[model samples]
Target: MTKRELIDNIARDGLVERLVANVCHRRHRSLPDLVQMVYEVLLNYDEEKLMRIHRRGAINFFIVRIIENLYFSRTSPYYRQIRRFAQHSDILKDE
Candidate 1:
């Protein structure tokens, strides 16, 4: 299937439905967009890493951070090409 079709499938899968909703609530983004994030990260990271973080039953948790870091976070290359994804994690000051 195409990426779009896979994303749609991810969104519709009942097991992930609420977890996807929770991620959307936390990140203030859309569901398919969140699924897209998972798709991208899945490309770069290994399935073992993803499964380790997301697990078979709860991938949405990982999807939230993936999307947040990839799109909204300002510190990493996710936001600008200036910083590397590994070396920059300057999110701080609230705690």
Candidate 2:
């Protein structure tokens, strides 16, 4: 499938959203941003690679890893861009 087609399939199936929800769990506020970020990352991959992943039935595992890394890795862009700010806001609210 083409890149756009693969992306459409994934989005239409709500795979990214479901994986983000599963990864974020109680962090509901981060769901939308995380899902968007995951899509952005996925878009960086070429159509051939995405198709290979789909053929191997590794799409879910690959996306789950992306979500986990984006959410939990301190050096990830998501951490720097969203989670860090979120943590600071929570701290300020508590203070």
- What tens-digit string does per-residue lDDT give for candidate 2 at 1-95? 78788889999999899888877886758778888989998999777888899889999999999999999999999999989999999999998
Candidate 1 segments exceeding 4 Å error: 1-38, 54-56, 81-95
Q: Please, what are the lDDT tens digits per residue for candidate 1 over residues 1-95?
A: 44344445665774344555554464433455545545666566665655555445455656656665655567644446422322344344333
Candidate 2 minimal-lDDT segment of 10 residues: 22-31
Q: lDDT for model 1, please.
A: 0.52
- Candidate 1: worst-modelled 10 consecutive residues by lDDT: 81-90
Candidate 1 matches the true fold with a TM-score of 0.40
Please report the candidate that would top lDDT against the real structure: 2
